[model samples]
Target: MKVFTALEAKNRFGKVIDAAQREPVTVTRQGRPSVVIVSAEEYERRQSRAWRNLLAVMEQTGRYAAEQGLTEEALDQLLADES
Candidate 1:
């Protein structure tokens, strides 16, 4: 990742786009990271992988709940308690 201040990124927007094509570019505001610029392909790939991981986790949790005889009401009550 390449770090660039907000002003630098704005002034060299074209270079930022070019850099993003090759890898992610980190844009910072007041020394704090604000955003990352990545190629569309990379972004989509990461999003897809994240969604798949979330689905797998949900499936595993569902199986565990089934095995433990956890009902919707019990789960709801647990969530309500947490809140």
Candidate 2:
């Protein structure tokens, strides 16, 4: 990751974009970390990976629930009871 001050990033916006294409670029404000800039492809890849992980967790939860003899009706009742 390359660090750039807010001013530098503002001044060299094009360079920051170019650097972000290779890897994430960190922008700082007043010596504190502010934001990270990543390439669009990287962002989409991460989003896809996150979605897959969420689906996998949901599948595992479903399997666990099935093994515990939980049914859709019972699950719905439990959720409704919380309201």
Candidate 3:
């Protein structure tokens, strides 16, 4: 990842976007990291993977709850709460 100050990123927005296509870029303000710039495709790919992980965890938890004799209604409630 490449770090850039907010002003520099603003001044060279096109270059920053171009760099983000290959790798994420960190944008900072007052020397503190604030935001990340990344390609849209990369961002969506990450989001999809995250959702898959979350679903796997949820499935495991639901199985455990079922083994513990939780009712269907209660399991549905638990899943809803997690969401």
Candidate 4:
């Protein structure tokens, strides 16, 4: 990964794009990391994997809730108590 300050990223935008195509680039603002620039292929791949992971977690959560006999009303009551 390559790191660039906000000004460097803006002034040398071409280099940033080039670096991002080769690997991820970290852009910082106020000396703190703000965002990452990644190739479109990598971004799409990560997004797809994240979606699959989220779906799997959701499925498991629902299955566990069913096994625990948790109903919508019970879940609502629990949420209300938290507030």
Scored by TM-score, the top model is 2
Across 1-83, the per-residue lDDT of candidate 1 in tens digits comes to: 89999999999999999999999999999999999999999999999999999999999999999899999999999999998
In candidate 3, the residue pairs with backbone N, CA or C atoms under 3 Å apart (3 or more residues apart, or in different chains) clash, namely none
Off by over 4 Å in 4: 71-83
Model 1, clash count?
0
- Report the Cα RMSD per candidate: 2.9, 0.8, 4.2, 2.9
Give a tens-digit lDDT track for model 2, residues 1-83: 89999999999999999999999999999999999999999999999999999999999999999999999999999999999
> How are the candidates ranked when ordered by TM-score, highest leading?
2, 3, 1, 4
Model 1, runs deviating above 4 Å: 71-83
RMSD of 2: 0.8
- What is residue 38's positional error in candidate 1, in angstroms? 1.2
Q: Write the per-residue lDDT of candidate 3 for residues 1-83, one digit (tens) a residue.
A: 99899999999999999999999999999999999989999999999999999999999998997899999898689899998
- Steric clash pairs (candidate 4): none
Summed backbone clashes in each candidate are 0, 0, 0, 0
- Which scores higher on TM-score, 1 or 4? 1
Q: How does residue 79 of candidate 3 score in lDDT?
A: 91
Minimal lDDT window, size 10, model 4? 66-75
lDDT of the structure predicted as candidate 3: 0.95
